[model samples]
Target chain A: MERKVCAHIQCRLGPMRLGWHGTIQTVADVIKMLFKEVYAPSGADKLMFYLAPLIVLIAPFIVCALIPFGRNLVVADVSMGIPLIIAVNGFGVLGILLGGWSSNNKYSLLGALRSGAQMISYEISFTMILLFVVMISGSTNLMSITLGQEGTILDWWIFKIPVLGIVAFILFFISSTAEMNRAPFDIAEAEQELTGGYHTEYNGTPFAMFYLAEYIALVTNSALATTCFLGGFLPPCIGVAFVDNYLNMVPGVVWFFAKVYFMIWCYMMVRWTFVRPRVDQLMDFEWKFLLPVNLVLLATGAAYIVIWG
Target chain B: MSEYIILSIFLFLGAFIAAAATVTGLLLGYRTKNTANKMAPYECGMETIGNARIQFKVGYYLFALLFLVFDIEALFLFPVMMNFREIMAGHTPLSPMIVLIDLAIFIVILVSGLAYAWKKGILKWE
Candidate 1:
């Protein structure tokens, strides 16, 4: 799907051979990966090298449970749902750091360090944006958040909070993209510079684990953005009777996935569009700029709630 | 709550699946390549240098320091923000002014710390 989007945007054939436009390319890649040599470096720290992939792979899946896919489709509607999701995903960086360190390879270690700083800095902004949503929604419960935006389209958090809502949404998008280490922030795995970065020494299933975790994190983060801002599973009602009724006829799960896939498409588009920033530039943008803006947004969000309420 | 149980189970399931896939790959993967290059660390196509464990710069550790401070601050602010609406509406015995003023002071202090880091060039990369 990501390749297909890249092809569409760039005017080229993406995956024409394997399945319909290379739809099953991923399946073929997995099979090849499974049969490939699972090599372990002689100089590597055996324990950590083996453990890092598991840690990285599990973090995203655990967070997936907290996302409310539909009205009642959530796996674990924990009380601390929002904060917990961000915190759990934080663990992925640990795996990356460990993977790089244990690989006993220069490129992997450097890649890990770069990604660690990028992810941690962006995470502060990411959490602040989610806190912005929680401030508006009044509770961290994922269900309440989804149900709170029950009215027309304007009632959604993105439109409901005026200027700050849209601003927070965009900030959330950027920070989450960075946190996931996708294309623009993908210097960790920069093909030319790092030569596969942290996973340089990994092969077979372990490497596949990192690859799968990346996409899983993508879906989890997109679902989070959708649930927090776009109104999870809530049909886009334009305040008219006929249209609203017809829209409601479609299941909330369908709408939920539609929004998620759309957010994923948006991610892919941004990935293919921009060039990655230098490491110093990336850090400066976060600490000097994004963090301060987010802090101010938090202050304004508090003020907005006090006055508007 | 049952929710917590389900979450734990989900976590274990994820771990199990990852472990299972890895084991499956080990069982079925190629074993013929026993060359010294296969066991060596990949530093592009060239031979690797001395060791991968060189001393990193202090800038990396400084971010960790700042993160720890802000992350701990978040742990405190979260509970207050979560119930800020209730506190303002007189649901609690405490006055709303006390809460707002406290939050203002906290954030002001945090931002000041950040500014000090910025101006001192602690944020600058070597």
Candidate 2:
């Protein structure tokens, strides 16, 4: 879907050969991946190499359990939703680190090192922004956070607090994009530099695991953004009674997924328009620029509530 | 809690699905004749050089250290941020001034350390 979106954005057809405007291309790719030869280099640490993809694949799976899909559709509506998500997502980084170390390749090592630093640094601001949301919502539970954005669309977290909320939301979008290792912040798998990075040695199913995990993380992050900044599962009604009633006719789950996919589409749009930064420049941007801004934003939120509330 | 139980199930299920997929691929995947060249580590189409375990820059280690310190602080700050409004509204037993002063001190110390690190050029890649 991302590829198709990118292709159409560039006024080109993608996957014309596959069924239904290449909708089945992903299935074909998966089948091809499963049948491909799984190769392990003689120098590779076989145990770690095999374990890495599994660990990477597990992070998003666990997060899925924590996120509230709709009012009552969540798998696990844990109280520590945001914090646990941040912590669980770190496991993916561990998997990449192990995968790179076990591969025993210079490019892989460098890529892994870059990724570790990049992600760890950006995560500070990411959580800070999440903390900002928790402050506004007054609860750590994901469902509560979503419910706090009740009423009109303007009641959403992004618009609830005037300048602070949107600033934090934009910061959240930027850092979350970086957190997921999306393009523009994808120094980890800058193929031009690292030739597939941490998964450099992986082929066949293991490579597919990494590939699938990236997409899953992408969706998971977008879903999180939808839940946090946008009004999750809440229709975009502007306080008109009949209109709101009509909008509510559609299920909340539909609104939830629609918002999630819209976020994903925005990601795809931004991804295709890229200007990759030097590894050093990228690090400086996060550590120096993003972190301080996030801190100030949090302080502003605190002031906003104390003064206005 | 039952949530923890469900979470554990999720973890095991994820790992199991990943393992099952890999096993299925191994079972169905065709083997090719192993060549020595095919088994060597990639080095951008060049021959493998010195061990990949060669010395790396300390900048990454420095960043990791800084991250470890800050990340824990952020975690500690979460609970405080969540209930800040209620506390300010005198819902909690503790006075609002104490909480305010504490957060101010916390952020001040955090920012100063960041400034110190910045001045020392620890964040610089070189």
Candidate 3:
């Protein structure tokens, strides 16, 4: 199964290990291995270039499976679902790098390099935001976090304190969007500027897979945001205490998806409505703005609990 | 629990449908040809040239490095956040002031790193 392939690769090549190895174990290596035996480089031989991209495109969806929707709905409910999701994303980057490198185009290579930086940069804050959520919820189990928000709207972490929660929500949303390579943050594949970006040379099913992965990731990030800050399945009203006890009447599953798609709609709005920022501006906004703001918010949340409790 | 089950079911079904669609498309759309031209890397309708991989700027690597430093530091705050109530509520002899001071020191160290990176131009967009 594709899940097995990802797990196998994920274990031997997790982010920390892969980061240390750098470009040696990247997509370029994958292509080189494939072609090490082949001699000719022309005409009908050009078709193999399509295979790597196709595989890359389809990858994110498989990883998305591991992301739990509710208490029991994930493919593999590893306690570290958050890290698993992040690792899956890291794998998605290698696919892009390989697709770009294998194409043997200058533009594609440049695009891949840009994407590598952009991904590694946003992932830091993105991972930090998840850590913040986990800390507030007091559990690494994502399902427990969603359940903690069950019943009342106030149960949601965002509603626990208006200003800090909202700020955290906004920060999580922005960093996740950039991490997923969506619009406004999708400079890696800007068609007019980078000529279709990293997938420039890909075609056929390989291209289709990468295309599918993008949309799937868009949905995945939305689902994660829904669960993390917006009260996964709980409706957006009423008292936390009242809902927590009685909301169990309706199936938790339904509430879970209702929240997930609602978040997806919000993501779609940003993707379609905004003009993309330049790469430099995106990095500046993250390092200078979002990171610092989250730090301050964390401190505030800590202080709030300290004095108020 | 039912919620997780439903999600897994939906996920598996979605993946199955996608795979089927992909296999069907591959069968229907792509031509099966045994030709040398089809196997070569596409280079905008020309012969492939030069190594595609190149060394990247150290600045990007610096950003990644800086990210790890701050990220790990942020994680240490979690235990403090969760156990703050107990620690302050006479669970441990440490006073609230002590906890706050300890956290302040950790954060100060983190911020100083940021300042160092900034002064070194590692955070610069240029």
Estimate the TM-score of every prediction: 0.98, 0.98, 0.74
Point out where model 1 deviates above 4 Å. none
Q: Proportion of native contacts found in each model?
A: 0.68, 0.74, 0.25
Model 3: per-residue Cα lDDT over A120-166, one tens digit each = 77887887777667656766556777777765677798877667788
> lDDT values of the candidates?
0.89, 0.89, 0.67
lDDT, model 2: 0.89
Candidate 3 whole-model C-alpha lDDT, 0 to 1:
0.67
Give the Å error, residue A260, model 2: 0.4
Off by over 4 Å in 3: A1-75, A236-249, B1-29, B32-50, B54-56, B74-99
In candidate 1, which residue pairs clash? none
Please give the range of 10 consecutive residues that has the lowest summed lDDT in model 1 chain A.
Answer: A33-42
Residues A218-265, candidate 2: write the lDDT tens digits. 899989999998998888889999899999899999999999999999
TM-score of 1: 0.98
lDDT digits (tens) for residues B1-126 of candidate 3: 654564456545654654554455555553546465665555566766655555657777788788667656655665565466567565777887888898889888888888788788788877
Q: How far is A226's C-alpha from truth in model 3 (Å)?
A: 1.4
DockQ of 2: 0.81
The best-first sequence of candidates by lDDT reads 1, 2, 3
